[model samples]
Target: MRLYIDPGTGSMLFTILIGLVGAGIYSARMLIVKLRFILSGGKKVDMNANRIPFVVFADHKRYWNIFEPVLREFDKRGVDVVYMTASPDDPGLQNPYPHIRGEFIGEGNRAFAKLNFLKAGIVLSTTPGLDVYQWKRSKEVQCYVHILHAASEATLYRMFGIDYYDSILLSGEYQATDVRNLEKLRNLPAKDLVEVGIPYMDEMKVRFEKAGPAPKHETTVLLAPSWGPEAIFSKYGDQILKVLLETGYHIIVRPHPQSYTAEKDMIETIMKKYPESDRIEWNRDNDNFEVLRRSDILISDFSGVIFEFAMVYDKPVIYTAANIDTSVYDAWWLDTPLWTTGILPRIGHELNGLNLPMLHSIIDECLNDTRYAKGRDEARSEAWEHMGEGAVRTVDYLMKKYRELNPAERPDKEA
Candidate 1:
């Protein structure tokens, strides 16, 4: 007799087994620690090795961009900020800052959530699900503020994980609406939702304004796609490139950081097939904003970068109809009509099939056509209410939260 197993089934089983074992180990460790405490005099664990007024936590270095502008604000205000991470190799820990202190809090879900003594007056982060799931110690900080990294729709954002945050900083009206709706749906308390635009994009706008005219390049098309089974690369990776190359347009294919590993085999195969040429470049660099800055237009599938491109430069974007695999992730996002709620439809021309002529026509329309121009501008304005001065707003909000937490510490008003 032979046993048959689907690859997906095997993978799921492996993940479940690992998760169970890890949970068991963590429970046992916590139990032992508690027992030791009861056996002896009630002694406190010193997880708060370096407690600071402002503590910022990140899951990995990739999220460092979210904290960059905040850190700069902290520096300017002469406020010392403590940076903590669960990633052992986060390079942000190495970046020297006079007002910022860094610490690598080890790795794994247990280490990430076992942080009980790491106390702070005001904690701020873009990372979701902080100290809520991996461990039961959720109230490790006084005030927790969540900053929005992506300006996507409601259900697409983290569900219960976001609820744990005391305050949420939103970039646009869409996010604020989502939070309000989620609160009503879940019967949860109204969170302190502030409409502070994304900090990085605010900086991007300033940089773009200060910099002279972008260097002229032959009409360049950037193919930057999100990582998944239904990504542009998985659907028609090489075919898209082939068509673009034939059209005499410069092509830059920038894969998501995870895509290089998640779909390594296919990505490598495509790169090998089409070696680097003057007309094509495979971008491995994680910094895609520069790539977006250089490209004439963007070709993407359901990536948040679409909002960044359209809202910032007012450039045109060509998007593939999102091909989401419900089995892999959230089903609710698919259950609801995301396109109807979000500004995606208004900003870009959505392409369904891989028809070359249709694709070419859409690209042309994006470049020169004025049919959707007004709609795009209107959507951009509505979505990014605080378009340019997001960092300032964020800094102001953080300071207010800090003051609220430590009323006595705030300076007294003079007569």
Candidate 2:
């Protein structure tokens, strides 16, 4: 019996078959992964014999800015790396890095894209967007390193899917120890997390020192507000404006790229309200480190920026979590206060009812304390202990591990 069908129907059937085949392949991969665990329960892959093509995902522009060096290192190691960026923020992309650039896929198609990278080698992500972060963390990868942006321990442990990670390179020993504790927190055996310190900071610090002393800007205040599902304007937007105008410090309110893109009108409204608030510098492009380098004092809550200000630049950060609900937030954010890493004052939890006067007074205290200069150096020591210094140590260790497992040029693993 000859089966007859319209051309469209045939095309649809073929598409369906392709989809089914992909699902089957993914399923088989899952089965093989389980079998491998059964085969080698507690053993690292033989990196010496294996060579992984690295695929690093950079979701936001700023993240890409920070991750460029690690990608270059991967290239230097002869890692066939795929460095991707979704946002057009990276001007350097005009003269793109020598390694492969994988954009357009975004996070929705991560599984398909991941498989592509997996077949080639290991896929690594230094800064993960929500969707990409989820796909990578949901399952075990042969070699995917999550070099989280922050040097905080609590942030990594409380972060979802730590169990599935192969190696979490620590920015410092403090963060590394915190990651190791995930064993008890999640009731799994103690696993090792690498302490590399912050590659990003090392890059920044070198650049700053070479650039020479930062031009003394007036009492500079950096105001970066969070955006999306947890956008900033909703909580303490207006209130921050009131205080910033009154205090007279140089203010730069850079919205999270997510928030700026998602809520254009809201961003405009907020900008309109505070036209002269400290010479607003909205970073709708790349080069955030420039803004940070210029600013003296920093203010924010929950965002990774606090770590940047306190650790990398040796600046004191005032966390105005005026919009957060502490009891709910502490658990949800999971990561403990940054104070554990550096001096961090508690946030207001609620936006409007915040004691703005008290907040200013605290700011005054920090400003008056000439000892803060010394304290910043202390924070750097703490960061070094937590994240590390050389910046290359952690990556070197992982590459060393990778070489041990797979000596071949193509070990069938990706970063």
Candidate 3:
């Protein structure tokens, strides 16, 4: 007698509702613009005439690390950038940057409403799915630039995520190749793809260097998984943790930030099942560098953190076999295997149903093995080119495109 809606249906309905609200807001704003033009005695009005030159939109505070270095570069060069975020308490809002003006633009549909009617010369963002979901292209905005927040494949995003962007700043050349291939497959115009290494990773590297070496402690295993139906925790439940706990090694469980929100029930159930104790710990720090530095081994499932731990900390990773539904993502369009999955064997060992029981032995093997060192070096080169100069390169590309869009405002020296 009870009607139930599946997650897919619920998500579709929610997206539709947000789209309707955004369309209504857009219509209202357009009406106001028309009225203003009419009141000016039939004179044409340029909506973007008073638009800001550069804008950076951060949908969540988690991406502040990625945008911080770029904004710092803008601040250093004395270039003005509007930092708009949906999170009211975003750290970016409190950054001590003179040239970067930060503002909290509300969350969800409200944020979409403001962005849908945005007026700007150039807008750079780490958030994708622009023009495909609630966030639509603004007529007044000249260009939309997307920067990679992770050192993974660009095609890993949801279907049509980067397809609508004017330019894409990549972490590696291989990602650019994937983008170009996708464009060709979709018959879309080529977007400007600049290989600008991982900016946050660069920041992490600096922080790690300054922190010196981590003090000696018990061998720790960090379980950091992505969130969603295909995530390790979602698919395998507490089975993975059960096996790890039996290993008698100290364990640090750091669920993806979204897990606390999107998969609340699942997370709560798991946490209740295994309460924190001396041997087990839960980590939800805003900055993961300290925790990552302290840990020796990482266990993850398709999360970008695998690359972070392996490349940044030079640690071993034990990846789980989670068959992600690529049909719902841009990966479906590609014939080649994912670079993340392909590189896993080289950087870490696989943990699946068969190996679940041998987790402890596998952990011992990974700790004792140093064979993946070469693969990690190769991955770093292939996935993160121009390592130490990410922020500078990112700002250079954004400024170049800005100058191209606004020739009259071109400065003598690029930022």
**Which candidate leads in TM-score?**
3
lDDT of 1 by residue, 166-241 (tens): 8988867766776777677778889898988778877767777776446987888888888786778877767777
lDDT (Cα) of model 2? 0.57
Q: Give the TM-score of candidate 3.
A: 0.87
- Candidate 3 yields a Cα-based lDDT of 0.88
RMSD of each: 5.8, 8.6, 4.0
Q: In model 2, what is the error at residue 8, expressed in angstroms?
A: 30
The list of candidate 1 runs beyond 4 A from truth reads: 1-51, 135-137, 325-336, 339-341, 411-415
lDDT of 2 at 42: 53
lDDT of 2 by residue, 126-156 (tens): 5433222334232223566677666454353
Tens digits of lDDT, candidate 3, 1-415: 9999997786577668766766787688789889989999989886656788889999998889889999999888989889999999999999999989999999986898788878898899989899887787887789999998898889888999999999999887778888888999999999988888989999888888899779989999999999987788977899988998998999999999889999999999999999899989999998788899999999998888899999988888999777778998898998988888788899889988787889999999888887888778888988989999999999888888878887777532333
Best candidate (score: lDDT) = 3
Candidate number that wins on lDDT, 1 or 2: 1
For residue 374, give model 2's deviation from the true position in Å. 4.9
Predicted candidate 3, C-alpha RMSD: 4.0
Q: What's the C-alpha lDDT at position 286 in model 1?
A: 59
Residue 23, model 3: lDDT of: 70
Task: Indicate the residue-level lDDT of 255 in model 1.
Answer: 81
User: Which lDDT value does model 2 have at 31?
Assistant: 77
